[model samples]
Target: MRDADPDLFVAVAHACLLGESPFWHPRERALYWCDIPGHRLQRFEPAGGALAHWDFDTDVASCAPQLDGRLLLAMRDGLWRFDPASGERRLAAKPPYDPAKERFNDGKCDPQGRFWVGTIYEPRDAAAATLHCLTREGLKRKAGGVTVANGLAWSPDGATMYWTDTKAHTIYAFDFEPHAGELSRQRVFAQFAPRAEGQPLDDYGGRPDGAAVDTEGCYWVAMFEGQRVLRLSPAGEVLREVLLPVRCATMPCFGGDDLKTLYITTAREKRPAAELAAQALAGCVLGLRVDVPGLPVNVVHV
Candidate 1:
């Protein structure tokens, strides 16, 4: 059931080159995300409407908060423990792949406090990127056979896991054993048709990007270049479609005190001049009030 009325507001004005990985800090009551190409990390407090950001040496792909005051950052080089207040970062795990070819992309901490991160193959030639998980032992490769790894999210009960390969236009689901952190029975949750040759941009439904699951267990995914977000049922049915005011909808996360604020990050880097001009909020963070609340962010157990 799609909502006929579509409305969204600009929550933050930061013009990120490629904004992604949005997560809410329940304790701090703030939202944090990263700009991959811009090499920046940003935080926005909705209550006060305060926006703060920091520049980084490498591309900060994704991030999650820890029990302590530090943040777990998945950058191009490796996973880092970053202290936002002191601007200090300590290398947590070195990149398993060549940094020049692949880098971390979408990720979040699982409900069990395990930090999960995905990588993107810059060359776009093959399925060379992989998904990784960080626990007390160390970082380990969890899955592969993906080019642009994204849409990492666990179901409400943490019994099912979701992942996406943007290049393949497919969202995959796995039977997740939460206690053991094991994934099994990988299957296609949903798939979309790619844009045909010489097809108009407006006709393209776009590719799957970052995503999140709500309390109802519906997977909400941003459709990159689709100018929309999709709410899919547990059985992979499209329940709702959210129209965005931009070309590239990178990611969506639930925020606010009630966890009903849907914040969407967009992209502008390398976009055509005409498209960028048409969508002035291309790289801005947008928000929409939703009825269903979201699960609280699980802090990384470092």
Candidate 2:
């Protein structure tokens, strides 16, 4: 059953082609997100409902806040630091894979300040993607053999890491060592039935896209094509299911002065015309108030 809440509403007016990787800046009290297909980075200040965006020549897949107020962005070409005040970007690392066939997708900073990012293998024929960890030491491939790497998050205690492969309809968890940013004993955390070729939309539980963890250690994940977000318990049990008004919910992050607002980003790129017509707000950012506050945004140290 859907948890109907009056607090849910569209937080941004503009629609994006593919909105992903929403990060709530704690100090700025603002929300930052990426429109990958649109090649833009967006910011929203709820205090005045002001919206700002920066256009990029390449796809900006994900970003994380840095201690120096700059943004660490994972783009099609490489890892970069973007200065919003001056509109300048400095390359930190180049693409580890063939930029033509693979690009960075979902990413976030671990508790120890390392930026962990995963790739999307565009071929869609094989598991050719990999996840990498970036630190001052350099980029290291942490895991591999995946197609669409999404749903990256950590447990509240930072002892477990969660990651998902959207095309496979699987979420994986790993025992984590925060200090070294190491993942071990990776196992299936959750799995959904594959969306059949002629499957009805209402009959399918969407594949995992992007995710976040709350203070209670529950994992909240957006379901692409499922039109909902699922809050899962630590043991992989469903706690709450939030039915969204749109079809392609891409990701969810917690924001607000108290970190109780669940902000979700959706997608419209490549969707059928009939589907888009049915869901007018398919690509807009949506929000709702929640009782549990979320874990604080992890600032990237480097």
Candidate 3:
């Protein structure tokens, strides 16, 4: 028998381009995310219907809640500690240059209190990027070659890690020794077709953008150009499929009072006017109610 149809949960308007990196702040009862192309960070509180945004001078790739209640941000310049309350920013790391061709992309904090960030090549370049782990001790360890590094999440027990390279249409898993910041036995955990199985992909090279893990150890991944977020078991079996009004869904995170609401972000990058008009919600924030709640947001060990 086929699964039941997924429903439209929330149709948020006025989202910026390349919406990504959804993080939940439980204390504030808010959901935070970024728009890469618009260089902005946004927060939404479903409880009060409050929406606030911050525009940065550079692309904000991802963000995590710091132990002290501020935010640790991964921007185009590298890593920074941002005080959303006071509007102050402190640089944590500087990107190595090839000025016109390289920039920071997606990242997330692991359970071990370290941040793993990756870079991406400009549209015209073919050079691969790398993922690096940053520790509170001020040491950065190169985890080696990655291209178009995008989604990131850790398993429920902190014993496995997942990361993606959008250009590759592949999600990889590692035997994660979280307490030590070590990875082993990299293998394919999931993959996507160039299209939504039967439909033509709205963008080139259908791949994953961002992903999240639930308390049940299942994964929810956003499919850029595929117009859906796919939930899969740890063995990589599809559990559910959520259709989005927009094709370029970038990421998903769990938020709300019980962390059972799934919040998603999308992108409008590289689309023409006609496509943009057809997909007005393309870069908007989307939400849905699910039976499963997500794991707690990992705190940055400062």
Candidate 4:
């Protein structure tokens, strides 16, 4: 139940346009995240304070590690196989939708090594976005009716899956068959009060963004523009609220040797100049120490 210290140090570059989809690489002992609008992938080594970035031609929304030390990237153009060592990348699968109207957003590798990626319908008019699973057969649509798809996670036992529609201010749970990589019995897991028209920033609790699950099966999710992260129990009760120093927290991941180090990625894209100036850590990757350890990052079997 500890909140991130207000004075937390920046874990990476202090100015990512829109940081999202952070994950802990157990093998590298580091943290990786995407700067979606910036078209970049970031890697930070906490132990040595080292930082590395790979620029991309399109928006790289999320990434998952592979067994061979390569990365599976969910970019606007397609699913990509990227070799970090050699900086060589190739298209694995083409985008399922038009890249101009929809692009991949939040994503993660399922426990069974399938890459599950969601999309964002940019026009903000309808529920056109959907979640897709990348398996040996190809990209298959798993869920739909989301405008800004995000907050993907799974339970420790691998029996339940979680997803979010940030535009709808709702989080959903599904019966998951881990071995088969299937989802069923979708239902609302949590819902927050939507921001009223003309609501001030301080009055809004924020919509769900990206999330991760702990070893205890609790879900930890970032509330974008809410200035906090909420840890929810399996039944969807809010267990803890960890306040953040910035307003737009996009995602969080657990790192460090014991997986107790919580890393948060924030956003600055299109934020007011006055607000960004006031919040020095507006787009920086922030870190804090948490009490509970998280589940290890799953590798995609490429």
Candidate 5:
């Protein structure tokens, strides 16, 4: 119930263009995240204060760790296997949507070791995006009628799945069958009031962007343009809200030795010059200590 203001600190000072998809690698004791608009994958070693980056020719939206110590990346073009050690990349599967209009966005691996990724319809005109599950059987569509598919996470018991559409200001829950990688009984989990037309930016409560789940089964989600992140209970009640120094808080993940450190990524790309000037920490990676730890990341089987 305590506020996050006193515990928060800067974990990294790198100002990313559009930071997203933060993943904590437990074995390596490192944090990995993507700068979507910047078309780069970044790694930060907290112990030594070392930072590394991998520049890509296409937008790298999200990624999940694999059992082979490589990373399964969901890029603008397709699914790829990237070996950090060798600096090599290989195509795994081509994108299911049209490369011109839609591209992969937020994604993560399910408990069953299947990579679940979603697309973002660039036009933002209609809900044309789809979410897909990638496994040994190849890519399969799991859900559709989405605009900006994001906030992908699962419950602690692995029986429920959560997803969000930022443009719609809604979060959804599904009855998940982990063994079969199926999602059913889709329903609204949380719904925020949309910003009124012509309303000032400060008056906006913001919409859902990215998310994570803690050990207590509570959902932690970033509220883009709201300047805050929220911890919501399983039934969709807000338990706590953590204010951030940045307006576009994109995503959050738990890391550090005990997994008690909460790291947040923010966006600076396309932001107004006046807003960026006032918020010096707008695009930096922010962190804070938390009471509950997060679940261990699921490794992709690919």
Candidate 6:
């Protein structure tokens, strides 16, 4: 991977987060993400570099802006409707597998306003979680099995649902019937070749964590252990590489007024003292200016 231009990126937040799930709220002109292990939600307004954070009693894996001005949150155990303005958190529903040692991971809403999330085992159970769909009518549908589901996105036309299993290091495409929230035709869309370093292998294969899809249908995915965010074409060809200062960069989101700035979240979990020393900005939030503007993110409907 080529080194990113330092001038294009400046560290915005000095947060020591196991950061994931970066989302842009256009109305508020802010970026939202989570420190998963830290059990907190953070809101960063980049224009002036001011940030506000909320600590949750439990680990929050992801969040989405709601049309009603609330936020849809996926906590470790269940779904929650969080009114950040009022600081109220009401349980929406719990998935069937919300037993101890399980938690939601990465997720996002569809263009039609339906929310989708996936789960994972707290201690790294390879096959413990599944994907689910949350509809407007208070229905949760079991979408499919995913071992450590991380990145979730939708195609430009809403006809395709793209999801990733971080451990598998592969992105899969499904035929999504948006009106009914039905998924079919599962096919492998992209796979990560192992890095030059010899790391232990796993059942699902690669390590693709959080991701975002641009307006041109390219996927910018954070390869956690790979130490970089890779921009790949819809056809799974590597187009560009955005290297991180740390080895554990978790997710990327496009924000800023013009939507051309790419904001990334990093993590500091499980690093050795030497590694952490080499990458002091391990969990710091990083930003960049890409050439293209991102597609508008969809807000969840309450």
lDDT of 5 by residue, 170-267 (tens): 99999999889888999999999889999887888899999999999999999999889999999999999998878899999999989999999999
188-254 per-residue lDDT for model 2 (tens digits): 9999889899988877889999999999999999989988999999999999988888889999999
Question: What TM-score, computed on C-alpha atoms, does each candidate reach?
Answer: 0.97, 0.98, 0.92, 0.97, 0.98, 0.92
How would you order the candidates by lDDT, starting with the best? 5, 2, 1, 4, 3, 6
Higher-scoring candidate on lDDT, 1 or 2: 2
Quote the positional error of residue 73 for candidate 5 in Å: 0.5
Give per-model CA RMSD.
1.9, 1.4, 3.0, 1.9, 1.8, 2.8
Clashes of each: 0, 0, 0, 0, 0, 3
Could you give candidate 1's per-residue lDDT for residues 51-136 as a string of tens digits? 99999888999999998979999999999999999999999999999998889988899989999999999999999989999989
Q: After the best TM-score superposition of candidate 3, give how far the Cα of residue 40 lies from its true spot, in angstroms.
A: 1.1
RMSD versus native structure for model 4: 1.9
Whichever of 1 and 4 has more lDDT, that candidate is 1
Give one digit per residue, the lDDT tens place, for model 4 in 1-302: 22555656577755799998889998888888999989999998888988899998889999999888899999999999999899999888999999889999998998888899999999989999999999898899998999999999989999999999999999999999977787889999999999998999888989999998999989999999899989999999999888887889999888889998888899999999988887888889887777899998889984
On lDDT, the stronger of 4 and 5 is 5
| Full ranking by TM-score | 5, 2, 1, 4, 6, 3
Clashes of 4: 0
Write candidate 6's Cα lDDT for 101-190 as tens digits: 678889798898888888876567566668887886774755556678877888777888888877667788889887778889999989
lDDT of each: 0.91, 0.93, 0.81, 0.90, 0.93, 0.80
Could you tell me which residue pairs clash in candidate 4? none
